[model samples]
Target: MIVLAILTGVLTGILSGLLGIGGGAIFVVAAVFFLGVPQHAAQAAAIAAMIPTAIVGVVKHHRNRLIDYRYLPYLAAGIILGGMVGAYVANITADIVLRRLFSAFFALMSIQMFWSSFRQGRKAPAKQQDHDKH
Candidate 1:
């Protein structure tokens, strides 16, 4: 179990670095398949793990002046509301239902992303804009 956890963590870190994602998918899938954790617990754990990661990323982005701080309050408000609704739904739903839902959602997202990339490869490049107009 410990070995599986460590492997999952390592895979999550590698995927995060390579894909610029926070690895919540990795955590959720690992918890479900490997650790036998329920979907609600997996989701909660993924969110908890993301907090520190988001903090670090935000700090780094802030140091580089890459953040728009003024919009944070609005984003935070929406996130809080969504989190509440998600938790409520999770509370009422069966574990298998949540797991299946997450799995389906993830699979759809992957398929859509793959389709997007495939379509992108078939598109012709647009003409470059001349930016030095006087």
Candidate 2:
């Protein structure tokens, strides 16, 4: 169990570095499958773990000029509104239904991200045209 946790953490750290994302998904899976944690508790633990990881990541990205802090207000507004609605719905929903819904939501988002990245990879950036304005 301890070895599994250590291996999971190592894999998650590598994935997080490669993808530029927090290891929330990996943490959730590990907690539920390996640690025998409840789904909701796993989700909460995953989120809590993300706090410090995200802070350090943000610092690194900011140093690299990868962060556009100007858009934070928009991001925060959406997050706050969506979080409230999600929490309310989750509290009122049945466990099985919530689980299915969350699974579907994650699947859809993963597909979208995959497709966007694939398309971006196939496209070439616009080149300067000779007919364009000087």
Candidate 3:
């Protein structure tokens, strides 16, 4: 159990750093599926896990000049407000319903990512040709 927990945390950190993602989905999936955690509990754990990881990731991103400071205020405000509201709503929602909703969200997001990748791949050759001409 401890080994699995450590492995999950390590994997989450890797994904977060490599992809600039929050890694909430990774935590939630690992906690619920492998650790036998309840959906609501897993979600709460994932939210908690975000704090340290987000702080570290942000520092690295800032160092790499990947962040646009101009939009920071608005983004921070929205995240804080939305997170509070989301937490409140999530607390009132049933576990099964939340699980189903999370599953559907991931499914839709995965499909969108795949479609975007395909479109980008198709455009790459044209972009390369244009670049070569210049």
* Predicted model with the maximum TM-score: 3
lDDT of 1 by residue, 13-72 (tens): 789979987698888898888899888888888888888888888899999999998999
List, in order, the clash count of every candidate structure.
0, 0, 0
Tell me the lDDT of candidate 2. Answer: 0.77
How accurate locally, in lDDT, is each candidate? 0.86, 0.77, 0.90
TM-score of each: 0.86, 0.70, 0.87
In terms of lDDT, which candidate is strongest? 3
What ranking emerges by TM-score with the best candidate at the front?
Answer: 3, 1, 2
Q: Give the runs in model 3 whose Cα sits over 4 Å from its true position.
A: 125-134
lDDT of 3: 0.90
Better of 1 and 3 by TM-score: 3
Give the Cα-based TM-score of candidate 1 against the true structure. Answer: 0.86
Instruction: Please give the lDDT score at residue 26 for candidate 1.
Output: 86
Query: What's the C-alpha lDDT at position 71 in model 3?
Result: 97
Candidate 1's C-alpha runs over 4 A off are: 124-134
User: If both were scored by lDDT, which would come out higher, candidate 1 or candidate 3?
Assistant: 3
Give the Å shift of residue 91 in candidate 1.
1.5
How well does model 1 score by local distance difference test? 0.86
| Ten-residue stretch with the least lDDT total in model 1 | 125-134
